[model samples]
Target chain A: MIVDIHHLNFAYRDSEILKKIDFTVKPGELLAILGPNGVGKTTLLKCLNGMHRASAGTVMVEGVDILKMRPMEIATKIGYVSQKNEKARLTLFDAVLMGRKPHIRWRPSDRDLKIVEATIRHLHLQEMSLRFIDQLSGGELQKVCIARALVQEPKLLLLDEPTSALDLKNQVEIMLLLRHVVDYHHIGAIMTMHDLNKAMRYADSVLMLKDGKVFSHLHPSLVTEQMIESVYGLPVEIHNINGHPMIVPKDSTQNLCC
Target chain B: MHLHDGQIPEEYRKYIGRKFVFLLLLCVSLLIALLFSISSGAAHISLTDVVSSLIGLETSKKIEIIVWNIRLPQAISAMVAGAGLALSGAVMQSILRNPLGSPFTLGIAHAAAFGAALGVMVLGGGIMTSNSMGAVQITNPYLTTVAAFFFSIATAAVIVAIARMRGTTPEVMVLTGVALGSFFTAATMLLQFFANDVQLAAMVFWTFGDTARASWSELAVMSIVVTITGIYFFCNSWNYNAIDAGEETAKGLGVRVERVRAVGMLLASVLTATIIGFLGIIGFAGLVVPHIVRRIIGSDNRFLLPGSFIGGALMLLTSDTVARLILAPHVLPVSVLTAFIGAPVFLILILRGGRK
Candidate 1:
């Protein structure tokens, strides 16, 4: 397993954030986390990378316990893309090149430079490589951030709302790009997403959380209409649109008969 | 193991080459400025005599004394102090992620002033006597500098403590710095209020920031400190570049953010404290030179650090030269000229609104 979390729990002081979460993902697999607001989606991602220490249980990545690893050590094995999308004062090329920090010696070697250039090319950000990040649109900035994460060459990738700021076309492109990266690099990607239909369509597996508890953890094909309604506290219908499952909200005006 | 030799894109190659040319120009200009400052002092030393003296060739005794004893040391001191201040300013701005974050803006200058005032009123036995312009000769210059260093570092400690308690948010740090500055300014005012005429004269002169005050010994100290610290800042250039992104992003890039911030702030404060201790309060070389250099060289700290140093030295040398020549013989303080020059340029930069 690329990531193996068993009975993981996290808390902020006295308030529990994640409760007994257990999940395992292999390389080249995309695991999409679905949850309502304030349901510990982001907290779980932080725990996997040891940004927030787990209160109980173990998180093992590549058969090594993450709690024992140094931040620099973990950084080489896992790349995390945060949701805060503020542009830094850096050219796009330099920003992506920064991802190689963990692997760099005193200075960047020829190999490091080649890897960065390759990643930027792969992302098709060559046009804006010299432009400052502040000049880029939201979609372009998101892609740069992803490219930076990709250049880390980690075994696992974690993304927090990667597509939230994107338009429809950009969102689809980003998802496809991520999927392609996972397949080509043979790395596991776990991302927290708000869009249920997108998650169902793109993710190999889905983990749904409700009020800091695991509501369901299953393959996308195994998720049912009842599971969505119970976890989200809303009535919804799941229709198979082509080969993908599409979620449609039921009529709110329909009253439940006593 | 050669990997993709010459794979660097044409644009990036051009970027590196342009930065190199820019750096070269700054170096040439700095050299020219130093030569000009050395040659144009109160004594009538021609450029030929200056060059002859510089190269250790034969020159008249009086010419040698003016160039070597008086003007060369003063110009070198100005360059060293300016480089130190500008380097500190660039590092602070990058680490704090605030454009206005500099030694002057962060209360280090005010603290140094207060310390110098304390040295004048208390340690130096309140100067000799008050003259017509309230200018009195200080009894002990070394004590004044030591006291200034002590207080500036103390102020930095307080600010760092506050940051530790309240998080290193740019808003918190800037506000705390302003508050500390006001506190130190008020403390200096209190000292001035109770001081005698001689003490007041000494205190006033201490704050005027004259480059002529830098003796050969003080210049030596400043040069050594600046060179060592400057090299240290250069070596950590990539770490600083990572920090410019954001704290969390820096951490994700495996930078120890808290450690880097604390150490960077301490070194910056030390640089500020040492220079301001010797030179008194030469403002805006720290504040303005780094911004101008950033506008020219882009925000990469690797280039920004050295660029700011050269640019800052050039600015201070020019301003000091103007201070010496504009009034001629009755020279004004270099700080006055830097303020006159730096304030308007800073205002224009702000009004133009191209600043990152």
Candidate 2:
């Protein structure tokens, strides 16, 4: 396993955000966490990256305990791409180059630059490399962020709602990029996403999160209609399309709730 | 999408070249400003005589007093305050991730001012005059400046800590700083009310920022501090670039986010305190200089940081020169002139930012 979260419990102030959760991802596998809003998906990702410590359990990357390791050391092992806030205003290259910071001290070497350049190239971002992120479209920026993560050369990668504001084309592109990252880079990826269809299509494994704990952790093929209904808190219909699961609401309400 | 490619300019690619040039330029400019400032005061001393006095070749007692004893200190003080205040503001702006971050806006300057008032008005604050300029040896004005600066920094630290612990928004940072600054200003005013006539007058003028009383000895001490810190800060310029690059990105890159911000703030606060100790509360140098520099050199602190220092030194000197020469023998306080220049420009930024 590349990442191991054992009996995890996390809270913000007085309110508990995560509880007694056990999750793990094997090397080279793409694990997609599917859930409704406020279900602790992002929190779970933070735990794996050592951004937030688990109150009751432990998060281990590869064989090293995240709690015991220095944040810098953990950061080098598990690269995380997060939701971009307003403060980020640097150009794509400058932004991606920052990903090499964990490896180099005081200054970046020629080798670091080569690695960053290769990561950007691997994502086919040569055209948009010089552009500031804010100036780029959501899709382009998402790729830039992924490129930055890849520069870290980590065994594991974590992402939170990487396609939240993207258009349909972008949403598909980002998911495909993640799929490629897992297969080509042989990196273990754990992504939390709202789109069930996108998750089922790209994810080798799916983890259903409900009320701060993992409702189910299984292959995408094993998530039946009954399990989807139980986790989402609503009756949902499931369809198989080209060896992938398609989850939709039976209520024709258009928006699915879980 | 990228139009040109994100590759850094080859000139800036090697940190050594850009930073080295900036350091050399800042030193050269400081030297030139020092020379220009000595010659062009309210006094009618020729440029040639000013140079002669600076080199210690002049023997005329009156000319020596004018150049060495008076204008030289004033010039050096203005340079120190300009470089120190602007550098401090840039570092704070980068750390806090707010363009409006500065000692003046955050009320660090006011806290320093209040501490000065308290030292003078509340605790034997009057100048002891035996030498000219009513030498303030007994009062230890440096203590007041240092204390005020620290108080101001403490306030900022508390606010940042609270913001971090509570996960505060930018509006909260602004509101908190304003409230703290206003409270400190009011307290200083109350201190003034209880002060004796002479103490009150001294406190009032010092808070208003007059470099008229600057002496060579004081400026030398301040320059040493500014010089050391300036070199240290410019050395870590890339660390700042990493932070603004994005917090998660910085974190992923192994940049210690919390530690970086804390260390940056401490260094910036020290610069503020050093300037406040000697130059008094020179209004808006911190607030406006970086903003202006940002426009000229874009937002790369690698360039923007040192650029602001150079621009600030030139700017404050220009403003001080105008204040001195504009009225001849009847010189106006530099604080008022800085306000005159700073206010309208600050208003323009507000208007422009609003329009955009």
Alpha-carbon RMSD, each predicted model: 3.1, 4.3
TM-scores of chain A across the candidates, in order, are 0.96, 0.93
Q: Which regions of candidate 2 are displaced past 4 Å?
A: A13-16, A87-89, A241-244, A252-258, B1-31, B43-68, B127-147, B160-174, B194-197, B227-232, B342-356
Report, for every candidate in turn, its global Cα lDDT versus the true structure.
0.85, 0.75
Q: Residues A220-256, candidate 1, lDDT per residue (tens digit)? A: 9999989988888889988888888999989872664
What is the Cα-based TM-score of model 2? 0.86
Give a tens-digit lDDT track for model 1, residues B1-356.
Answer: 11233256778768878988998998999888888888886666777888889999998889888888888888888888888999999999988888888987899999999999999887864566555644455667889999999999998888888888887666777788899999999999999999987788788888988787788888888888888889889888888887787666666667777777777888889988889888889988998899988876678887899999888888898899889899876788899999898888877876776555
Error of 1 at A163 (Å): 1.3
lDDT of 2 by residue, B1-356 (tens): 11122343343255446545765776687677667777786567777787888887955898899887778777767777887888888887886778888887777777888888877765665563454534333356666665666676787687677666755444565566778889889999898888877787778767767676567777877788889889888877777776776666666556677777766666777778767766677877877888876653456676778887876776677678778888876666677787688778877876875674
For each candidate in turn, the TM-score is: 0.93, 0.86
In terms of lDDT, the poorest run of 10 residues in model 1 chain B is B1-10
Q: Pairs clashing in candidate 2?
A: A102-B253, A128-B2, A130-B5, A130-B6, A232-A258, B112-B148, B120-B125
